[model samples]
Target: MGKVTGFLEFQRLQEAAEAPANRLKHYKEFVLHLTDDQARQQGARCMDCGIPFCNTACPVNNIIPDWNDLVYRQDWSRALDVLHSTNNFPEFTGRVCPAPCEAACTLNINDAPVGIKSIEHAIIDKGWQEGWVKPQVPRIKTGKSVAVVGSGPSGLACAQQLARAGHAVTVFEKSDRIGGLLRYGIPDFKMEKSHIDRRVSQMELEGVAFRTSTFVGSAEDAALFGQGLSTVTPAQLEAEFDAVVIAGGSEAPRDLNIPGRELQGVHFAMDFLRQQNKVVAGDKLPGQTTAAGKKVVVIGGGDTGSDCVGTSNRQGAKSVVQFELMPQPPEVENRELTWPYWPARLRTSSSHEEGCDRDWGVTTKSFKGKNGKLTALECARVEWVRDEATGQMKMNEIEGSVFDVPADLVFFAMGFVSPVQKVLDAFGVERDGRGNARANTDDYRTNRDKVFAAGDMRRGQSLVVWAIREGRQCAASVDAWLMGSTTLPR
Candidate 1:
């Protein structure tokens, strides 16, 4: 360890953020990265725990203590290497991932945990500035070809790894641009598209090919996400590539199938977010959905809902309110009881901090509207209790607790249910009971020959860090399948 007594001496320092008033004026990242000195101090807080729970807690299993020590000792080049060895995209995770690694930190038992994510953000940003993040072109070509569908984090990671291993890799994206959900589902304010673009350029130098607006399925499947600019049948991909990797994200959103769901103002959250992203990119969208000057009601208490709150505030909404059917978690979790694992607790995002009236234990009963236009939401207070015989939790509406909330616009941010079905059907891939592509982590191989699945497509909607892990592991699996052996890290 760089500093034996570091944990006792250094306090946890967070990345500073621009003021809410000033930041709301534009859709740009407001959180500032840590300076070198600040990052070193935060890195020094890593304790000499016998086993680093943060490593296990992190989906990509980042070497936390080693890099923390390296950063503390000013060995930044080594720290960057250690950070990139496990995670392909630390910047993406640093910006958006809810650090479960911090929750599982040994120091979190009593005192504040080390600011690992901030340190990671520092190391990677420094690497980029120093020109250390360059292409790793292989010396020998493997002569094998791989087709990776979807250009989100998972597909990008898989393609990069395979390309570095000397295989010809082509990434297929249905969207006009490369990044799948990261380019559209996430707001630009969280992370600018420039990050994705830079990586795309690096991957191109490493021998990966990107085929944007090219859906790797039937035309009908392409139509599911706005007629992909070009279409490639599953048969064509199978015939041309040695292996096919399904990294397409889970895209089927869960709908609020209640009365008035067909109202004019009610819309899925992604539809609102995708349009805003296009508008920011200088694309003119007729009948574009905007939160400007409207009382916005967002349903769902997850990250997507928080994104909606932030976007609505930026668009000059009159008021924003969020609803959650689940009861509110505690403000803080009991660390003694939940140490070494992610805890169930309340989380307030930057969007929530900006502005939002949040309510829990509430359910929408119906939507009240006029002439097919949404006007208000009829809601009710509900209680969840366990059924004696069934032993399953069920919701019961409380008597005389019905209420109505003013809502000129309603966004359903509940969550995604599964991947777009037509794509899976086009590939003749079997699905798990949960609707994700059926594939185990050990091999990432799908039921079909020469086909594999990874990331959100295989595991359902999940964190970006998890997608990177799946991509790396799936790349190794594909390499082994093609060459009979592989040295690529999982």
Candidate 2:
């Protein structure tokens, strides 16, 4: 409440960005965080609502109004403190999180919501620039040791939290680099790897050891399900660490079992994206799949599909098309029906804005190829109809509507199914019906003693912010289970 009438006086402002033409030339972050004044004005726009829906809407439940007030008062240092109280990685969420908090803002009922994400981006960027972001090394050491599998946002957050709570924490990553999904699965243009690198440096400073290129399973399991440089058996990990957490990503991509699935030039979106990320990191990957000089078709209209479009355009694809099996969402949401919740509406990403032919209410019947090479997709228009008996909508292909989408390359981005099962099998952990490791949110403990699961490995594929929240909560649970009490927050 620095200025009670500030909401009436200010308009929501967006972060600036590089022009698409200029940004497509390099695989660096194109968008810029708000400047100091822009951040202050944005913060001031947060109304003095009786209740803060933005906080609850955020996965981490960030203390939004407090930080907004501090930012409006120009108390940068305290603003950073309030920002970091709940979320460990504001910078990551600020950049990539599809800000649900903004959608639920009280001001959004009738006006543009407060620019919370932009303010967070500004605050965190400034915290780094001003050296306010520093390691919170524990003052006293607890002899208890813990091992965290995977090094994505969730794993990293959990490891950092436990390390700060005076437990010796070690993070395991199968890849040569630490960040599992963030290091590879995401395209460099969306978020440069340098952001992950600096955080790794900070975690190391706080005594959270990172073991890269190391598999934490049997040798046989390592060979079958892991791509690590070294192997550490589950028994060894169990005997050495006081507790263990399975926090890897949901890597089992939902596959398209069409005729040309085995054909060359047809690939899962992550495989295509990961290889490009490694290439951008200066790794020489021979026969790297490229959309350059090819007509590209990306299936499954989601963030993954949008990323493929952006990456393909950067690689000089001849043309790009995206398909969504479901019906198109409304261009604008009905606020009255969906207030304070995530709305179903068409979302045009920056990648889409760059260029893409997006089609909805369509499905690929089969992949069309020649000489074992993918050349096009045999697609068809479809309608969704309700089944009264089942109360579920079913797809009905429209007769005589089959068509071909010519393509030289195709990427399937239909989302993930579950965590890599071999890893779970190697650990002897049980699974839910959906195949995610069986665990409850209350304590995040698995059926096996000394084992816990969180993030995508437990809850299936979700947003990065949700992963961070789960990781934080899981850490608190692990801490409590080890010492019979915990001071750490969820």
Candidate 3:
């Protein structure tokens, strides 16, 4: 601990966001960063807890105390090293991660926890500004070739680690560009693509090769799943690469199976998001759909749904409404009982502040449309009650609460179900009951000997930090399996 009483002296300070009025006009990052002195003060707030539970709470297990001490001492260079040791992409996580580490902070028991995410953001941004971030080329080449399927955070992290471990690593992405979901699915306003571009440049300097628009499966396989992409047979990858890692993300979005699903102007959230991302990258779509002048309704009250609200607002929608199936949570958690643990409470995002009508305990009954275009949504408010016999909770629709809402466009943001079955089927990998690629967290090896899996593809859809952690550990497992020994850290 740098300062024993620092936590008592300083209060948590987070980054400021742009004013809702000014930010809605553009699709750019609107977060205002803390100054150097403020960042240092926040870093010093790390308590002298005997055990650092914050580290464990972080997916990559970042050395929080060490970096906090370094920042407190004003040693920027060393802090960056410690920060990068665990997280290869702190910029990504610092901006987007929900900071479960803060929830697990010891200081959070009573007082406000340290602004760990803000400190991380400051350190990484400083690292880049000071030219401290550079390529770590391996001293020796192992003369091994590895193929990493997908170039999202997991695939990119795994490929970088393997390449640094002296193996020739090649990453395959089905998109026209690298960064599977990061390049496409996420909106540019959240995280600019430039972050991914620079990392790609650094990875290339470390001897990792990237191949875009190369799908690793047969045409029949692609057609079976209707995954629109050119297919490269699995046998070809097996022949060319010594070992294969499947890091393709979970792309199977949970669909709404209610009537009128096939109506026009109704779309999955990803499709709407990905297209906007592409547009931001200067790619033009002739018939691209826009929410401009339309009354938009977004179903699902998660991050993705928030993103839709933000995007629709930016696109100049007439009105925006969000629906949540579950009952509305309390604005504040009972800290006495939920201290040091992530509490289930109401979360209002920046997008919500921009302007949105949010409803909870509501379920969509059906879509009402005419001439193939959606016009309205039939919905109902429901109540959750305990069953007398089963003693389980059940949702019961209130008979008179049924209603209709005008909806020119509807977006389903209900989250992902599992990884696409095409690639898994190509490798003949077994799946769990949840349809996630079945692989132990310890080794990450699939049923096929030379095939391995990681990230959202192996585990279900999760945070970017979790994907990076899985990728790094999977690399260590692959390294040990290939060379009979591994010096790489998990």
All candidates: TM-score: 0.99, 0.98, 0.97
Give lDDT for model 1.
0.92
The local distance difference test score of each candidate is 0.92, 0.92, 0.91
Model 1 per-residue lDDT at 397: 94
lDDT of 2 by residue, 85-158 (tens): 89988888888899999999999999999999999998999999999989999999999999999999999999
**Tens-digit lDDT string for candidate 1 (1-490):** 8888899998899899999999999999999899999988888889888899999999999999999999999899999999999988888998888888998899999999999889988898899999999888999999999999999889999999999999999999888888999999999999988889999999999999999888777776567668436899989999999999999888899898898888889999999999999898889999899999999999999999999999999999999999999999999898778897888889999999999999999999889999889999999999999999999999999999999999999999999999878789889999999898999999999999999999999999998989999999999999999999999998
lDDT-best of 1 and 3: 1
Error of 3 at 63 (Å): 1.1
* Residue 348 accuracy (lDDT) in model 3: 92
Model 2 TM-score?
A: 0.98
Could you give candidate 3's per-residue lDDT for residues 269-309 as a string of tens digits?
A: 98899889889999998878789999999999998999999
Clash pairs, model 3 backbone: none
